[model samples]
Target: MILYIKYMVSLRCKMMVKEELKKLGLQFVVVDLGFVEILEDITPKQFEELRKNLAQSGLELLDDKKAILIQKIKNVIIELVHYTDEMPKVNYSDYISEKLNYDYTYLSNIFSEVKGITIQQFIINQKIERVKELLLYDELNLTEISYKLNYSSVAHLSNQFKKVTGLSPSFFKKLKEKRNRNLENI
Candidate 1:
């Protein structure tokens, strides 16, 4: 039996879900970001117990098809932006469509309707967050960060970063450096 889980994004969440499944004596074949495949069918009592337990931890057991699809979409984007070392070479729409086995238009419409943001916007937002993370790490220069994030040029990255954050990338980095210096002095 396959069960979809909402808000199971991080490795820590995965661990929690695994522990929950073990506690319920539910043997799982796969426990991924958004879904789990168990070796045996879950009973109604088990399902309800699992749902209540997950809810206490701010996670949800999803049953609605549209909600499951949306969670799947989110999981894909989260995995891509936060986990992967490199972005895919193909267009984001094509990548998402292929990954979800759904038409791009359909996915985009549903995602926008449910999330109140277009998929492109979501991708850009995620990219900007990733840029912030890279900047804070201070291990990569702007040029390197641009190339790593697959921006066409540093100027383009700077423009987008400024647009999203209202602060230039260098300024954002400076803020992090200042914070570190203050902490060190403390």
Candidate 2:
């Protein structure tokens, strides 16, 4: 049985779900970002208990098709932005469409309606968050970060970084460094 889950967007979330299933003696064949596959059928009572447990852990079971599609969209973007170091060469819309086997227009419309944001905007937001994480790590310079994330140029990345965050990348990095030093002192 494959069950959809909302807000289960990280590997840690998957681990948590697995732990909960183990606690209940339920065998999960797969526990992914937005869904889970059980090794065998479960009783309705078991299902209800699992549902309540997941909800308490901040993941709600999804029954709506539109919501499930939106979760899939988010899961794909999250995987691309957070997991992959190098952005792919293909257009995001085409990649997403091919991956989901849906018309891009239909997917875009539903994503906007359900998420209150365009898919492009969501991509940008996730990219910016990824940039922040990379900056915090202090492992890669801005030029390398821009190239890894597939920006046209370092200037394009700086422009978008400033536009989204209202601060230059240099300043953001410095701020993180200062905050880390203060934590170390503490």
Candidate 3:
């Protein structure tokens, strides 16, 4: 059986799920960002117990089909912004539509309706958050950060960063308490 989960965005989350499944005496064939596949079907009682354990850790077991679709979208965006080693050659709209097998217009409408923000806004937010991370690492300069994130220029990146965060990239980098929230929270 396949189970979709919320807030399963990090390696730590994956480990927690594995450990919990072990404690519950369930064997999972695979566990990925937002879903898990188990070798055996779980009974209602077992499912409830697993849900309770997951909830205690600030996670939720997704049962609704629409909710699962949303989670999948979140996972895809998270993977792109967080795990991808290089910028995509094509636009994110085309990439997302091809990857998810959904029309871009439909997906954009649903995402905006549910998220209270446009998908483009979400992408910008995520990209800004990533720039913050790269800045903190101190390994890449502003131009490199811009290039890595597919920004047209350093000035453009700085402008957008200021617009979203109310501070310029340099100012944000100098702050001692720079923080990057998880994609799900954003």
* Ten-residue region with minimum lDDT total, candidate 1: 78-87
- What lDDT score belongs to each candidate, Candidate 1 first? 0.94, 0.90, 0.89
TM-score of each: 0.95, 0.94, 0.91
- Clashing pairs for model 3 are none
Of the two candidates 1 and 3, the one with more favorable lDDT, higher being better, is 1
lDDT of 1 by residue, 1-186 (tens): 999999998888899999999999999999999899999999999999999999999999999998999998988998999889988999989999999999999999999999999988888998999999999988999999899888999999999999999999999998989999999999
- Pick the TM-score winner: 1
- Number of clashing residue pairs in every model? 0, 0, 0
- Model 3, 11-44: lDDT tens digits are 9999999999999899999999999999999999
Q: Which of 1 and 2 is ahead in TM-score?
A: 1
lDDT of 1: 0.94
Instruction: Tell me the tens digit of each residue's lDDT in model 2 across 1-186.
Output: 888899998888999999988988989888987889998887888888888999998999887899989999988888888888678899999989988999999999999998899999999888889889999988999999999999999899899989999999999999988988999999
Best by lDDT: 1
Model 2 accuracy (lDDT, Cα): 0.90
